[model samples]
Target: MTRDHPADFEEIARRFSHLWQALNEGSPGTRKILVDRVRDALDRGEARLRDADCDIVANSFVLEALINDGAATRVYRARHRDLGTFHAIKMPRPDHADDPVLRKLMLREAEIGMGLRHSHIAATQTVLRLSDGRPALVTEWIGSRLAELLQQRPLSLGEITSVMTSVLSGLEAIHAAGFVHCDLSPLNLLADGDLSRLKIADFGIALKRGSRHSQFDLAFAGQPDFASPEQLAGEPLDERSDLYAAGLLLSLLLSRCHEESDGTKTLKALTNHLSQQDVQDRPENARAALHLLGGSPKRPVDA
Candidate 1:
């Protein structure tokens, strides 16, 4: 169907099911025809649901574009039909959509995010259920990921300071809310152009303070380089665990800046203190780490 004359839900589903069956059991000629039909449906921007229940989320949001196709989830830049506001809708990959373990993880991330409200924390607006009974998280739209920005250009000392301060501030709030942001890598941080607006995103593996890690947590362990020593050991974690990751995140920023001034040296020292192998060796918390950077917890670094 053409974009102006799109296929209805029923027709789309029928084509999708036939394609699935063809791939598995149909003759070669039939499989080729089914493939072409499905491709045409997608090219026309027609909605295709793997299961009947998938329509709830598909119909609610007008997916503007695919933002990121990650290993487990696909994030879309979507506009909510009723609200008329843009958001990042995170849905599990089709293969993972029906997995109970992934559903629980997404639910847990939404639960942790809903309680957090900070300028440096990306808000989780709400969770929508897919037609197949899986959960999708609706989050504030952030156009840039820190990882992408780092690849584009080197940041100035002021930019690094600003970004690190924002991250620590976010961690402070997360810890105060009784949770540790188990994931704090560059990929999980969001920022706008010029490093002016930065926020922490992705709490898929965040754990409550003093709470034991679940089996699902193991599968989603954050980036290896950013994971704390205690986290790698599967030991009990507290705010300090997140502090370690924050320190590494700062180091990642500093590595790209290529400056060796006194200010840079100071930040490097702070990074060392934050990433100490022993939890006690690091700053007591994010607040203390901020102080070591010669700044107040409430005031961000001058950008």
Candidate 2:
């Protein structure tokens, strides 16, 4: 059978197998060698996250296919030589890495991603140092942007429902994890081909509830069309802010589904409820929206 990972997967596996054997075989010398090997592998910082305009090896992954480039960071499609799997690596520009606030934001995003789990949410695989010694985050490659996909074709009501439901499911998961995706927007949501699979992504500006993030002197100016009013006011947010963006996306999709259809009124009302200037008037969280729209929502997790 063909294997996916590089040569080290087997070497790493061998080390682990020996370590397990040492546990039972009462072999301290053998165990020490295996443990040291595993530690060295980890200290090497093999996995990082995406592509811009270059080909290089950060650790175990080879970065290629310059996919996105911005002022602060670059993304590249990357390959894990050991596993033979492809992923995206995101890392800061070398110069920006020296800015304390930007550096903190990058690391904070990684920390938040590492803590959350949901099928509708993109998986953040690992955070490691780049060849240039900057921190990078590696994640499974998302196929397309939702904004880009919508422009390509008109989706049916059923398809829009699937996409919105999936997005809300992801927001619900973010809430259960006690972090607000303070920067939710269509631009940040990703989808695979056919709009059947959607994942809420880009937690870069996310904030933990009750934590003072101004320590880094970072503030999010909400997206004009999709941001909640409270977000514009720079108030500390909770899950409600994310629900607002979810509602906005749902409305935008529905408006395109059938501009003057019979179901438009109800979806419009739901969207308005979500966009209410007073956060109290809106559905407090994704669960509330799921209740309004009728879907199985995840149970909330305690702090």
lDDT of 1 by residue, 147-262 (tens): 99889888778888888878888889999999988888888888777454689999888888875465564633778899988887777789999989888888888889876787
Q: RMSD, each candidate, Å?
A: 11.5, 10.6
Candidate topping TM-score: 1
Deviation in Å, model 2, residue 96 alpha carbon: 0.9
- What would the TM-score be for candidate 2 when compared with the true structure? 0.75
* Alpha-carbon TM-score of each model against the true structure: 0.77, 0.75
As a whole number from 0 to 100, the lDDT of residue 198 in candidate 2 is 79
The 0-to-1 C-alpha lDDT of every candidate, in the order given, reads: 0.81, 0.73
- Model 1, stretches more than 4 Å misplaced? 1-58, 82-84, 215-220, 295-303
lDDT by residue (1-303, candidate 2, tens digit) is 347667768877997786687766866777667665675565454333324423455436777587788788888888886577988888887768777777788888899998888888888888988655688889888868888867876766566667767877888888888988876776787876645467877778788764434545755554768876767667777888777777778778876664444445656677788777677888878887877766323222111
lDDT of predicted model 2:
0.73
